[model samples]
Target chain A: MSIKLTYFDLRGRAEVIRYLLKYGGIEFQDVRITIVPWGNLKSTVPFGQLPIYEEHGKVSNQTIAITRYLAKKIKLAGNNNWEDLELDALVDTTSDLLEKVVNFYHERDTERREQLKRMVLAETIPFYLSRFEAIAEKNFGFLAFGRLTWADFFFTTTIDMLDAMTGMNVLKNYPHLQGVVSNVTDLAVIKEWREKDKSSVVLANDAK
Target chain B: MSIKLTYFDLRGRAEVIRYLLKYGGIEFQDVRITIVPWGNLKSTVPFGQLPIYEEHGKVSNQTIAITRYLAKKIKLAGNNNWEDLELDALVDTTSDLLEKVVNFYHERDTERREQLKRMVLAETIPFYLSRFEAIAEKNFGFLAFGRLTWADFFFTTTIDMLDAMTGMNVLKNYPHLQGVVSNVTDLAVIKEWREKDKSSVVLANDAK
Candidate 1:
């Protein structure tokens, strides 16, 4: 099936799907649009949003939905129904953290942005990271089960994005999260893709 | 398995899960905590969030995650992997609408609240509802596939909540969405539950 992912040039929402497709050895056209043209392009898409996945000419939006679809196809989803539920919960939790960090990134007001940054760095990040750290510790470094699931991929990508946005190694204090990052990035396909993908490479360098 | 759902007395986030469990003939303890005592109960829960579903002593949070778990157990999810993806995408879209409406409901500033309410009523509601109405029309009155799935249940309960919050019959202009509500409420199990559940009855009355 011909697949094409359309989103902005940044790794904002489509990064995890890109990583999952690469890790699963799937090939697709990565169409990155810039901000200037997004206005013209917005009305044509479903939900008028980005990171849309078009498979066999059928388009679908929503980042989590697209990611879950690809994850299930790649066997990155859990083994059974219950396991999938667990993985879904973790992915949603990671999304909660992502929203907070993204809000901090996009805030225009200097005072409010500082307040958001402080909340994220002090309360939000630690609150979520500590829970995730405990979960990873229990599951042998994977986020959901004892094996790699889509939640790990989602967490890994979000952590990279968070670090890039905040210019802080947010995972440095959380060893379990660090392990998750290493576990996901250590995949051969992801490493290869990161090396070649300009957006991922730039994000990696920015985080460092 | 013994099931217990803990949330505030209101149907803010847990209502969809409640509706799904009821529709599935799954009996659960509806544990409602008011705001006054929530401060004391906050730190004990995972992520310190509401609508935590406890099953046989295991606890899980994230409303969509919990609802999806129960929906699968009751055979309310889609028939196949692709269908599940469609359902997930629809659920996420409904969640997007829920966020906007809830923002308007909770806004304290009168001028800001008025602006948010206008946006929700004018742009957000129509944007999402028109898409959903078209989908329902194509699916023979159901949301995702041509059968009753969890997305339908989620959409039904959320529409009810939106109506209650906005004090408007949100489904009035969208006949397809109204058809969806009728299709779900026509289920014998849901009808029986609504008749007996005071919270559901109150919401229905408020919407009326």
Candidate 2:
């Protein structure tokens, strides 16, 4: 299969896709663009964005959509349509959290960034993490299912980025969430994937 | 059949779900909540957000997931998994556009809001709209498919929201997008749905 994934070598949005691919043992090109050529490369990509997926010569963009495609290909998606909907809803909930954390991370102004950091740490993180912890608790250490789904991969990879941004273990008090994380990262394939490449797995700040 | 959709009486995020239900010819309890009770109702809803769809007893949040669920029921989703992925990627592209516009619309500071407006108008809107126009032109008046799909419904509904927020006809120069909008709005069921309920079809600003 001529499958190729293209993005900055950052663990920001593309991390979950990478995790899913590694977990599935899918083989394809992992294209990592550095900072210098991005400007020239940006216009050439679809929708002027990173993280485009190419399969059989047809390329597509959008992180979540691409993630779903790979997840389905790897048989990590929900068993039925209704199950897929549940997983999609769960991914979006984590996306809501990721969006907030990303905004804080991307903020350039020092004063405003500090203000956002406070709101995120004080209110936003607890609000979503508490809900997520409860859901993981109910799902038996998974995010939205009894077994590992793409939602687990999504949140597990995302929490690493979130923890990196905050400079602390954000899931310190949420054992279920921490369990979810461990369940994902401790998988043999995932551990092997991480050990395989340390360069392309850099976080957002380090990617810059 | 217990189908219920609860949201503020606004076209902000829930409009596409409303459109899908109308197009599906499905009878649903359209519960329009007013602003006064939102605070109390916020914590009660999953994800603390509006536009929650309750079917039988399963209550779910996240607008896109709900849209896909209703679309599948209505036979508006893609015919296959690959087709669904195509439609999903298209929806996510529009979502990228929507996120930028919503942030611009929701900014409380007047000066920063204006700055966002300029960037949105001069750069972001064109960046997305031109690409959308080309895709529509290729698809012969549809957004992502040769025939009407949920992506069309998504973009058509979202363009209305974007146009209202920008206070201008953003698609004036893009004939294909304009045609896509007209095609969706002129649908017999959608037209009837809107005509029957004017109170709940308000846009984001007026809903406040």
Candidate 3:
């Protein structure tokens, strides 16, 4: 049975999974849900939240979990015990950083947002991106493994999100990370998907 | 070679992994970092953060990743495909809820904190914990599989954390969730661990 991907129309959290499926050449049903008329669909969601994934009719919520599930299905998880762990770590760190961008809206006019972003730019993003870069440098410039894992894709997604949110380009400071993000976006299938439905994927607020 | 668990002595984020290690009966070198000597130890932490796991000299960060690594090592990740994926989803959801708690602190004002906590208590926590309860009810009353997965432990950990923070017990409204938390804590190993470290584990500020 084809997996059912449920989320809103916008390419927010669910887009990464969609991109993963497209990039991996996997077939699945895309179920787009919007805020309107959620009354009927409310009960069906795992936690009354959208962006759920159903495989063989067993549903799962939590976007990152759905992403990991897709990655696992596509064999995009890293090889070996250590590499797989690194993949999870890298993806999670990326998730945390992206969430900070989300929180920036709620934390406006407060020093907390700037404090948080400063921490991210100063320590968090640089730390993970640099570490991934080192791994890439050691292994022919791939993020986690010698090949592209979900970690690389996740890192690319974060850079895209951050760069879009903040006018300042996040990757300019990290050259190796720039290379990694460039490589992922330059993937043939991904490039095709991005261009094919550019309007659908692009967000108005993401005015880079 | 012994695995090295790097984190501060405080059981802030690393407690779950420590609990899992003790519960699983694995011994590791707990490398407590001291900040009083910040200049010395700052360079060692991968992301200028705590709770890094080093195995065979290779290092990693991200709390969820560390927990998953340990859980996989101890065979606590569950055996079947559905169980494993479900567990991952559950853990990710729990992590999302915890992030809300962190946001509560950053919000500053009592009014903002209350608003955030109410939103969390009303929408986020119940939405997650309730569905998790249903999943647990359907699958042996744990978060996933026939056995306790990292999701179960993470759920229990978050329950303890939320309950302590709000002075409102997680079990008060959600009976099934309370049951799951109880079931996990009642496990022989978890029970013993809690009994031995009651004072330290019970934070005073938990009761809002």
TM-score on alpha carbons, each prediction: 0.92, 0.96, 0.87
What is candidate 3's TM-score against the reference? 0.87
Please write out the lDDT profile of model 2 over residues A155-178, one tens digit for every residue.
Answer: 988887788888888999999999
Give the residue spans of candidate 1 off by over 4 A: A200-208, B200-208
Ranking by lDDT: 2, 1, 3
What is the lDDT for A87 in model 1? 85
- Over the full model, what C-alpha lDDT does candidate 1 score relative to the true structure? 0.84
* Docking quality category of candidate 2 according to DockQ thresholds: medium
Q: Which candidate tops DockQ?
A: 2
TM-score of candidate 1 relative to the true fold: 0.92
Task: Write the residue-wise lDDT of candidate 3 on B26-103 in tens digits.
Answer: 877877655576557767666566778877778888888889888888888857656667788778778777777666
lDDT of 1 by residue, A34-150 (tens): 767988999888788988998898888899988998888988888886778778889998998887787677766688779889999999999999988998899888887788888
Looking at model 2, residue A44 earns an lDDT score of 88
How would the candidate models be sorted by TM-score, starting from the highest?
Answer: 2, 1, 3
The predicted structure with the larger TM-score, 1 or 2, is 2
Clashing pairs in 2: none
In the order shown, the candidates' DockQ scores are 0.71, 0.78, 0.62
lDDT of model 1 at position A97: 89
